[model samples]
Target: MSIKKSPESWAPNADQDLGPVLILEPEEGKNFWQPQPANGHISVRISPDFLDVQTPFSLGTQTLPAGGYVREHSHPEHDEVLHFIRGTGKAVVDGEEHAIVPGKTIFVGRNRRHMFVNSSQDELHWVWFIQPNGLEHFFEEIGREMVVGGEDPTPFPRPENVLEIEARTAFAPQPADQRKPD
Candidate 1:
């Protein structure tokens, strides 16, 4: 059965680009295998790939295996809001540690340092949304391409040129310790 498009649509995108997702059907978003340590996956839900930055914010969903974590990092040009939708975790935002649980929303301003660690027995899931439209591109650049229902790939490392990718994406992560206050 075919799903009908929403009666109203957002502005059209360039001919080659898909338009903003008014309704995301199954298998609609771009998915990728998250690099090792986290060893999970991310789905780019909405971004400039579909809509203009002036209107649509970038959005993605990520899942992390037990004991997985995201290293400390910062986005110099964009603010981020993460909604903890599943599992429990610990979030460090600018040196402050917070408990993460379902329904908890975390706001990280541009240039603030942060990290997340999953402390649950099950997979941890969250929605990563950012202002000005761009996070999805960063994820895509460092992530290995994967399709929904495909076999999961072996755990992998970040690209050797991850620093360059971070530069291009406005991410400003140094070694976690280096960024912490002395």
Candidate 2:
């Protein structure tokens, strides 16, 4: 049996009508994946620009090769959530380390230093969401778009305007002491 709701409950508002549904296939996203310089990792931004929503969050997927690690950093203005989909890794949040695997979820509060390191032989796959939006623009500005099925170009140096971008985004770099032993 179906139940009826009040007109206000079912009605679409202006805010809802302003956003359109977006469906991005994996193949379509692969073309936008950008590899991190000097790191065996790639990321595909999935939201913000994709849907152009007015929401406060952005989404993206990242694949980290075995032994790859993201340098520790923190967002002074936004919180981050990461959900692991494959492989194993270690997440250091505020200098505390936790082993992570498929189905594991992590919540990092704003201004907490965090980084991820792939420890398994295979790739680590995860989707990350950042609150208050805008981080995707930083990634786009710093990362080079990867060509599908083609060799990656030589890693480009960090953008000269990184500090400017960081100031605009409230992204703060942190010194990392978590590294896989040789």
Candidate 3:
């Protein structure tokens, strides 16, 4: 398989000539990975491929409409950093409450349970960053952001592959025999 490159893909040849790294606004029309809505909450401007190195990391802006609430969820394989840019909200991390507002940065560790609640009238604008490819492909597959208002969308980290035969033998309650053993 061949790796596809984007027009904005960094070129190694130009790395040397570029003197100093400068900050610039993200491309407005750049296409981004759209994840499936989890509940009733909506996530706009989802970009999960901002920067990838040893670990596939991403950074993107997000807006949680007024009264939007994210159901309890957890990231099993990656950590997340959220920087609130507009509006105000609160995050329940591992049962601890933390207020979220512009200039506030929250770090969520992998496998740590958390949820976001927006009580302010203004839409919440925040920059979210994830490490080690957190739901990047999954979001791309489903399309549109995952909006969950009343349901939990948390899922375990799925490794590349796991054979059913091995899973049955490895885990307790072997159902293979009850289902007409092969």
Candidate 4:
């Protein structure tokens, strides 16, 4: 998280490629999270430069392009606050798919298995807030925190996992999905 800059750094390409060039390989060292895509799930950390703040709770944006899917997964340590800024999608929690659209917000509690898919024609953009602070940093600290073979629990249904069943819930339903979540 280095913010050093030169006096002329912002002067319209005056020092192109001079300030910082970052390359993070999660396998190479600390302060990085290792990520792997499996089955229908794909996710990537928004790069250090893209991060607005590097401490406490981490804020980042992710995309689930049309036809893309995030396999069932859960956060054991932190609850997540997700706000969909664009497009449409469906989130599956407790074995149910709930429709999602622009302006929709969904809160998935810690350790709850959940998955999301873009079922619409456009790409889905959502900002994620990881609570209890520094979710990304913690992931980096533990080497690889989220992935197909990682220790984090998958949101998908697994006979051996024994995920606690909770009353499924949602923020609000899109006009298309008539049934409301309680």
Candidate 5:
């Protein structure tokens, strides 16, 4: 459904030439989840592909179950910001550990190795944004499909093609050095 521009209506400005503004609720975006171990779900709020126009950044929410953690990985070509919304956890960025709490924000530069660990028994929920695209597609490719309000999918192993997906999605190869991981 394309929005039509009328005398009173509006469209992308010529000077800006950017994607439309998006206002989304917590669960209003496409969601995906890890199968067994991580149990983390990514709900995409906005992206270039989602907005159908090239944008400078993408926004999403990340939920990590108690004991679940986002594995250490980095986007060698993009910067990222993570804001903790709820729950307790720790984020290790560039080998430095920091407490994850509501209202806390972390900025990770390109090629920085980082991961989140849910230390408490409660679930960890946070919002993540990445610039210049990629993370949204990465989550979609690596996680099992999850509908907005659908029941969780059955536990499953990470896709065999996950490494290839990561590579194409601009993730710094595992170990941050070796091109082909064993």
Candidate 6:
């Protein structure tokens, strides 16, 4: 099967003229990951900026290293769906733990705390979508851009104003008991 390109390409350039369509190779999208202690990264494939739409959703891919995890957190205004693509892991959502494997889809409703922990030796990969858009902006504020692909994974220093950013986005943090493994 072959995929057809859109009538107009929307890739950004210095000129900043908006195009009718945006065509992006996987690598062309903005890439970012949580700094240290968070354990994974994401490649944002589509967002409002990328699509030039007022839609309230964003799409991206994430990879979690073995033994790595995303700390428990919640989006007060958005719901999230995670579709596992590779490897094995576990998702803790709202105090319940569930296995994560290829083809499994996890739904995290708004204000429910959740996190993903990679358990297999291999990396756990998944595609994620969040409703009401704007999560991309949070990622951009909290993460540094991966300028080049396949670079060595290193800890990114936590930004001093992360709490402020999180507050602005209503990204509530879970309590320590809720976030830690039982």
**Local lDDT at 109 for model 3:** 87
Q: 4 or 5: which has the higher TM-score?
A: 5
For every candidate, C-alpha RMSD to the true structure in Å: 5.4, 6.2, 11.6, 10.6, 4.3, 6.3
lDDT of 5: 0.77
Q: With candidate 1 superimposed using the best TM-score fit, by how many Å does residue 100's alpha carbon deviate from the native?
A: 0.8
The TM-score of candidate 1 is: 0.82
TM-score against native, each model: 0.82, 0.75, 0.55, 0.48, 0.82, 0.81
Cα error, candidate 6, residue 138 (Å): 1.9
lDDT of 3: 0.52
Ranking by lDDT: 1, 5, 6, 2, 4, 3
- State the lDDT of candidate 2 residue by residue for 57-112, as single tens digits: 78778777777677677898898999999999788887788998899999988988
lDDT of 4: 0.52
The worst-scoring run of ten residues by lDDT in candidate 2 lies at: 1-10
Q: Show pairs that collide, candidate 4.
A: 32-140, 56-133, 56-134, 72-155, 72-156, 73-155
150-181: candidate 5 lDDT, tens digit per residue: 88774667888888999998598888442211
Residue 163 of model 4 has an lDDT of 22
Off by over 4 Å in 2: 1-18, 30-38, 41-45, 154-157, 173-182
For model 6, residues 1-182, the per-residue Cα lDDT tens digits are 12234433444554554434566776678888667555578888778766555566888888877777777889988989999999998899887899998999998989898888887899999998988777778777887677664675556666888778877764876466666643
Between candidates 1 and 5, the one scoring higher on lDDT is 1
**Candidate 1 lDDT (Cα, 0 to 1):** 0.78
Model 3 alpha-carbon drift over 4 Å, by segment: 1-54, 145-182
Of 1 and 6, the candidate ranking higher by TM-score = 1
The candidate that achieves the highest lDDT relative to the unseen native structure = 1
